[model samples]
Target: MASFQNINIETQIPEEILIAQIMQLHESISKLESLRPCKQVNSLFTRLVKLCTLPSSIDIEALPQEVKEMRDSLINLSGHAEGLLEFEFSTFISLTPEPFKNVTLFPYYGNYVKLAHMENKILKENGMVNAKKVAFVGSGPMPLTSIIMATHHMESTHFDNFDIDEKANEVARKIVASDAALEKRMKFVTQDIMEVRERLGQYDCIFLAALVGMNREAKVKILGHIRKYMKEGGILLVRSAKGSRAFLYPILEEPDMVNFEVLTIFHPTNDVINSVVLLRKPKA
Candidate 1:
């Protein structure tokens, strides 16, 4: 952790240098975790948090593996850090320049493409047609998933983009407005999921972004809330990373609190690790 602490957050460091620092810290942290006292572990967690809270202008692709490992460690060591990381990632995406804004940096493009394909496949398999109403929780600054769905489905689908970040909502609106087709079909809202609980049941499909809530408990609460409001027979598409990549974006397994029937599991055909779980609200 001390090796990572030497990084100058104020300056724009080269990607290679950052990666090297991250590797060193990762090795050291892994070796010392068992021997270090709780105080030392907490101190390392604090340093990692500072490293992760990089300026939004930095390219996420350039982010080193050490930073990702640190995130996983933080979640394992102190559950409270999940919220901090979520906010940090949201801020990083929100500050992305218009020209470079896509689903993510180029390395992650395949993930979104695979996600879009999985979404379409699930909708078709479930016999869902002309899904007129859709909602995306944690849509982020670009709302690329919603944009893709709208483009594929054309005028048949209308999307509501929700996020707690006002700045992200503003940017998402601009991204939508830039495309004439998307501008008419999408709406951005700056509010928590609980704030709009009353209207959830109206949507034919609801997308849960990988980083929607602060922690698993919060996520479970969100799942329970959605169960209460989602229309019977409606589809819930959850995006999650598989295995170790789950550190970056925690996976949402089937929660014990919800009674949703698993409709399908779509795996990525590309290098990306994310999979989409299509869940259906059973008719009671």
Candidate 2:
């Protein structure tokens, strides 16, 4: 059993103690084949969430293998818990301004920079000078990827961000509105991927967020919907995880979609696990 005795939610927890609790909880959960509705697992998950929420300046390279493994296990468990509990954990976390402002933004910015650079590389390789119109599916509370890409290209690009969650749309809109430059370049669309398919051909580039669908079947359906509407020669950038973090989303080694050809996979330059699958809709 994992004891979170040293964890105090009201105060900052030491990195060593936090890591120890994560390791214990991970060990307990790994022994179970399937997670059932239980107080222990729930408690462990709650504690893990709290620990993750705490401010940490620890260097990733200095962390032990056990600590790293435990952290990854917790993320996997968190994803499973969201499905089992019928809750949108990531969305809920995003709704809260404090943790997102302090903790989430740091890593998200790192990811955004890497993704922007990779997009630039891919565009250049494809002989495309600029992505004039871009659509970001599952934009969440902060469309960091779109924002970062827009910043990288200056005023040349326009972004249409779509998300099923109205709250997420509102939050993202608010963020964009705060920046005068972003206000002119970005717009949030409160629609599911299927609903937005009607205007898909308008975008030069499309970003499929990793959490766009709950499962593989849902993702395939989303992909199918886009295939029917995306313009010929338009680029589709599907964000996914690599290596151990692949559990964050349904791993699509090779997307079996019609009319789309895989161009390349963009791996992150930092610790962020996201990899972008660059696909293009071929000209007829």
Highest-lDDT candidate: 2
Superposed model 2: Cα runs more than 4 Å off: 1-107, 268-270
Q: Whose TM-score is greatest here?
A: 2
Q: lDDT tens string, model 1, 1-284?
A: 23544656565445555445544445555666352235565466545444444322334334467665564563454333333333344445445565224435432345566677677777787887788899999876656677767876535688998988787777567556655766777899888998787799889889888777545667778887898888999888877644323444555666533698987766553444456778889999
Error of 1 at 92 (Å): 13
> Tell me, what's the RMSD of every candidate?
11.3, 9.7
Residue range 1-284, candidate 2, lDDT tens digits = 33445555455556666566657667777776666446776666655544454544444436778665555565566666544442233344444554334323432366567666776777678765667888989877657677777766635788899988787676566556656766787898888789875699998888898777555567778887887899998888887654434433444557455568888877553445566778888888
For model 2 the TM-score comes to 0.65
Clashing pairs counted in every model: 0, 0
